[model samples]
Target: MKDLSDKALFALVQDHDERAFAVLLERHSGLVYDLVYKRTRDDDDTKDILQDIFISLWNNREKIRIEESIYPYLHRSAKYAVIDLAIKNQRVTAYQSLLAKQDEPFCHPAETGLIASELQQQYEQEVARMPGTMQQIFRLSRDQQLSAREIALQLQISEQTVRNNITLALKKLRLSLGSDQLIVLLPLSLYISSALAVN
Candidate 1:
């Protein structure tokens, strides 16, 4: 039940303190699991990603120099880990195809739903245009269902900053698509296709 800062825990870990490492894992496991679950929506995959994150942390322990709060670094690491996992699983193409199929669901709708769906599509396309980091954050938080606090812990940003960035991104989508469209588009917006080409 020791509440060590990331720095202290990291130091102990560097000194080969297995107990310290376990404590670090216990404290952050929920954050890591939540972030992974949001991205994957699979219990088994979340467990896999959780193990991967901790293993990566332990393996890289000797190489990392932590002068700042370790939360953001760990969070960013988890974010990248999920992205890497997505690539390995070959899920990116399937996900994008699913998003692209939204047009089919929207077609049956008259005026209101049609416009909402079209605007949603446009918003998704715009989200696709964003840089990789933003898209990853967006997907992890929105698609994977991680809260800003969990995201900040996983990605290491201040929760306020997470809120601000997500807000800004959502605001842009809303302005472009209208409020009605945003509701329909939120989930699809998380499907980022640009990074899939490289993987």
Candidate 2:
């Protein structure tokens, strides 16, 4: 396996040769990690994105086309993964800001209740739209009332990542729920922060 060229290793990998796959991983893992890390800059995001890249490579091995080397393909994959991550985060942030600006004072108790119900529905819908990892992180923090540290340990991720996911989740919720409805959801924010404080 060690004696095989890149093309040979890829051919073996496509043929279900685990040894070849391992060799390819070993040979290019550092390069892939560096490429992803340079784009993400955060240790946790880098690790998660790097793992996803390899998973994608393995899953799509049969479809891979390597004319000469695998470097270009891996590099492009890493770049696209990072870009997707950024776009997800940005969508969350933008939605949060837009929702924040829609804040207005409610006139009646009945109106408040109506808005709260609507916001809750919208929040659920938006959360459902999030990536699986983000959805899981958000639920653990919000529904389970877990602290960032606890959530990190449970998910086997960095506390920073847990916090980031939570932030993004809140932004997404805010965007979906709108600012006027956020006053109704104030307790939710308080609950999350309180949990964090305990941790």
Candidate 3:
């Protein structure tokens, strides 16, 4: 494997050769790691994103095309991962700051009906806006009330992946919705966005 070029190794990997994939990991992970770490400045986050990158590679091996070095594709992957993480955190923070303004008296059910309906619409819209994996994690954890372990098992993904998504989902929801989901007392349908804060 050491003697094989990246194109050859990737070809073998596409054919489901685990050793070839391992060799590719050995060869390029450091480059990918440096880019991810530099963007995240957190070892733990870097590790999580890196694990996902490789796992995605293995899962999509049959479809990936490599002409020469694989570094370009890995670099692109790391860049997008960091951006996704940053955006999720940013959007979550913006919503939480609105919590203090929600002290308006609760409306009567009939009067609040339209506002409540709108709130539900926004909540569902935001959930749909989440990146694919995080969306799955949030829906399962929220609508189904599944534990992280259950979600991980059902998704055939790592528990850490479930946990990380949940943590970030909460963090971002706080920014995009509000802490405890008290956005102008809008009656949150996204109550589970705060799940990790207490846990």
Query: Regarding TM-score, does 1 or 3 come out ahead?
Result: 3
- lDDT (0 to 1) per candidate: 0.66, 0.73, 0.73
Which residue pairs overlap in candidate 1's backbone?
38-144, 39-144, 72-156, 75-154, 75-155, 76-155
Residue-level lDDT of model 3, residues 42-62, one tens digit each, is 976787688768867866777
Residue-level lDDT of model 1, residues 26-92, one tens digit each, is: 6777887787789888876666566556656765788887874566777887789788877756765
- Per-residue lDDT value at 101 in model 3: 58
Residue pairs whose backbone atoms clash in candidate 2: none
Least well predicted 10-residue stretch by lDDT in candidate 3: 190-199
Number of the candidate with higher lDDT, 1 or 3: 3
CA RMSD, predictions in order: 14.6, 11.7, 10.8
Superposition error at 42 for model 3 (Å)? 1.0
For candidate 3, what is the lDDT?
0.73
